[model samples]
Target: MQNNYFAAAPKYQEDSSNQQTNTEEQQIGKKAVFYYKMVAKTLGQYLSIYDGKTEYKMGVVMHQPAKPDHQGGFYVYDSLDQAIFADVPLKKDGLYFAPRTVIKCACWGDKIEYPNGKIAFEYLCPVQDMGMPKGYLATKAAMKEAYQLYSEKLKLKQGAGPKSLKKPTWKN
Candidate 1:
């Protein structure tokens, strides 16, 4: 456990230019309509599923019944089924509904050389919304923070965890 703790040292140098570019990109807004929505309470767990080998991030969103035995018939649950809906985290806000607990979307990319040649590859992050009872909003925020922290852990020390398999080519 002690050995697993994040290193106290800083990782890669912070590129102000890259940071500015990311800020611009985020301002662009959502480009697609997600089909899921969560209540902002039932958010249960936030995980960063990594394939150690591939380093692909999978965002999962999961939801369960609001309660058991206490059936609120002829209502939303009755219509939506025992399973509730959770929105994708990468949306304007976590407001949609879905059956899963994770949402994996492209976050960033890197350049690498494949065994055969070279290419550019990218990876995405995962978001999970639990939509708990009355803590939907609060839980959602906490989950987001959890994910953010998970990401920071990776940034704690760069070039040591996972490297991309893509290679970039600049043409004149």
Candidate 2:
């Protein structure tokens, strides 16, 4: 399969004179053109760089910040396939996805598979912000289990009203 991707090329003639140098340069140019054609054929329209805000589409380059902090830097939407394909570094603040985007997990460094069979690593921001990637919440079954746990806690609290009331409602 790998061999099918790269065909064996004919050996070049030895450059005995300066005119041979021109032939060598032509060969190099031909090889470059071939590579460009291959890239265009494989990536097609995805090869184009997206210009505008990340909100415009998934794969657009949002903005590159001048000063990078522990939780602030570059951001982009997942729709910008070229940015991800190029392996662009995420901002220290982590890559931001649109709210409607489905996050497979909240944990940083998790691998998320795209519909096209491409896999991307998740980078969560250490600090919470408006553009931070949102965590995935429980679905139907998990939500049901959470509801059951809440009910059980309520039952336990009813048995010890004054004692339970003394405890803080918010969790640490």
TM-score of each: 0.18, 0.20
User: For model 2, how does the per-residue alpha-carbon lDDT over 4-31 read when each residue is reduced to its tens digit?
Assistant: 1112222345565734233542453243
Clashes of each: 39, 5
- Local accuracy of candidate 1 as per-residue lDDT tens digits, 14-112: 486654233333432232112222232223443211111111122421212222232211011111213233222344333333223323222223223
Q: After superposing candidate 2, which stretches have Cα over 4 Å from the reference? A: 1-56, 69-72, 75-158, 162-172
138 Cα displacement, candidate 1 (Å): 6.9
Q: Where is model 1 poorest over a 10-residue stretch in terms of lDDT?
A: 72-81
Query: Measured by TM-score, how close is model 1 to the native structure?
Result: 0.18
At residue 111, what lDDT does model 2 achieve?
38
Best-fitting candidate, measured by TM-score? 2
